[model samples]
Target: MKTAKLDKLREQIAAIKAEIVSVERAQLTTPEIEARVDGFIQEMKRTVANDVLDSAGTLTYINQLGSGAGNWPVVGSWMHARPAIGFAMAVTLNPEAFRAMVLEAALKELNGGRQEHATGRVELVEQLRGKLRLLEQDEEAEVLRLEENGIDALRRADADPAVVLGLAA
Candidate 1:
């Protein structure tokens, strides 16, 4: 059980790494990174469809891990060595709850601006937001739900996926 928890924690850490890298790429301020943001968004969709993550919800988690200006220590340490492994999901994901996870993720992804994101510390955050923002109106519940649940729900989701699923179902 402890090993499982450790593995899960490592996965969460990887998610955080992805967010940081995305933010880092976003900070580049080059048109290319800006354009690549769409690529990141596509990546997010794939992650979500596979249930690997909930795109924007990952971004929100990235945002929470960041300082108000977008400096994320959790993302900082691993973003450099392994960008792919550090990705995280948005902060919220249930639409009936708060911010519309995708939109919320986009907002958090965009919130840091260039300076905060410029640090080499962040990972793939920049390559995605624009695409993430394109989510259909009806597909926005998860981000909002993240906002509503905050850390409490994330913790519960970790502790009891069955219970959370039961509640949601």
Candidate 2:
């Protein structure tokens, strides 16, 4: 069972690597590329949840959680459920498995740091929103600063002569 799950996870890892390489062959805008990468991350999470989880008895209960059958949206819906229940499952039942899964995921994303486009998963998940909000605020602040300082700074720097010449260089 362990070997089978590991093999399946490795196969998913290979698919993600191929996805990253395929993205490079395209001439997509940055946002478009980011969106595709985001899709890959979601797929990775889904792969871990679906493939690596579930042993016989646990599968029965997950089903008993009111799924009436077995599978996701249904199981997930029933688990709308106590957050602690999910947390306990993650910690007790499948912690090491998912740790390995996510580690492989991140290593694949970095491609040993050769891939410039990869963002850490935490950044992809959480910090990205914060980064984006901060960037928006920076842009608004910069526009105001540019209005206040733009002309005088340009004039002063231009009078220095070296600034303009350095820019041309």
Candidate 3:
């Protein structure tokens, strides 16, 4: 009786192992995961490209600050009193850090001493920072995954992981 029960348990364990393997096989294949990662990377690259364009535009505006073309009557006075306006603007135009600071300051002023408004602004800033950090972390993780999994799996799947990853051979 004891021997029969042990054999039955062993068989059940083997069956469970087989089921686990089947489930894993049913999950996303290496190629699928690589494609997803590549998509994410491309999306992030586009976002960064857009940010660069915005930063370039900001730089152009700063360059024209003292050109005496804008409608600001203070332009002449600003040019005389503060010749370093371009430098100041450059320091403040950082989209990630400086823009966050500006947003926080604007939120504070707009809140007008409301505690709930201040809290909401703080939450918004924290959320934005968290999202940016997650994107960087995800990219790092995907790169590491590709390196660890090796290109052999991709070849077996008949897909070029490098091309999918947008990496030049």
C-alpha TM-score for every candidate: 0.18, 0.22, 0.28
Ranking by TM-score: 3, 2, 1
- Note the residue pairs that clash in candidate 2: none
The root-mean-square deviation over C-alpha atoms between each candidate and the true structure, in angstroms, is: 28.5, 21.5, 21.6
For model 1, give the 10-residue run with minimal summed lDDT: 131-140
* Residue 58 displacement in candidate 1 (angstroms): 63
Off by over 4 Å in 1: 27-169
Model 3 ranges off by over 4 Å: 3-10, 21-28, 62-169
* Per-residue lDDT over 21-122 for candidate 1, one digit per residue giving the tens place of the 0 to 100 score: 545555444443544555565564565455433333555564455555355443444456545543423322322232344444545555656544244333
Task: Give the Å error, residue 104, model 3.
Answer: 43
lDDT string, candidate 2, 1-169, tens digits: 1234334433443454455455444343444455665565555556446644543345555444533343444446435754444554554455556555655555555443333334443344344344433433333343345556542211221122332233321
Residue pairs in collision within model 3? none
List residue ranges in candidate 2 displaced over 4 A.
Answer: 1-78, 82-84, 114-162, 165-169
